[model samples]
Target: MYTVSVMEDFIAQHYLTVPDPGPEGEVHSHHYEAELTLSGPELDEYDYLVDIETVEEVLAVVRARYEDALLNEQSKFAGHNPSVEHFAHVVWDLAADELDTDHLSTLTVTIWEDDDTWAAYEESV
Candidate 1:
């Protein structure tokens, strides 16, 4: 299988509702780094798994949408905590809508909340 990945970073604020709760429920910010990966069994006619330009475009869109925003207020988070894991899935969902998934058979999103911690989500086509 062939795979291609794109990466981007943004800053956002969110709060967690579980674990210690309390002040953690208060909004905090993170310098978020997101990585999107797509994999397929074969390359497209252009000899690439997918267009790098398209991936960059999608990542840009995502960065613009979330950068400097309060993620907990977004409808996408709704009732769930805006944890790194949840953020990864949200990134995957956003990319899925913007990407041409016909050729790619797998999609994975990784979100890094800090230098030491990250989470990911994956889907099969």
Candidate 2:
């Protein structure tokens, strides 16, 4: 299978809920990094599974929507914590909605809250 990835970084604030509430329970910013990966068994006539420019366009939208925003203020958070795991899925949904998935086999979104920690969500298209 062929795979392509697009990456971007943004700043956002969020708090976690579960077990003990610590400083993380307070709104804080993370230099978050997100990577979106598209994979398939075939490529188009242009020898690409997906257009890099298309990926960048979608990523730019995602970044613009979330960059410098308070995660808890977003509709997607509703009543849930804006955890990295949830963030990954949120990004996946946004990117999937913008892409033509007919030729793709899978889509995966990985979010890094810090250099040492990250989470991912993947789905078959």
Return the TM-score for each candidate structure: 0.94, 0.96
lDDT of 2 by residue, 1-125 (tens): 99999999999888887668788888789999889999999999999999999999988888899999999899988888788999999999999999999999999999999999999999999
Listing every candidate in turn, what is its Cα RMSD in Å to the true structure after a full C-alpha superposition? 1.2, 0.9
Which residue pairs collide, candidate 2? none
lDDT of 2 at 24: 86
What is candidate 2's TM-score against the reference? Answer: 0.96
lDDT of 1 by residue, 24-110 (tens): 788999999999999999987779899999999999998999999999898899999998999999989999999999988899999
CA error at residue 114 for candidate 2, angstroms: 1.0
| Candidate maximizing TM-score | 2
lDDT of each: 0.92, 0.92
- Lowest summed lDDT window (length 10), candidate 2: 14-23
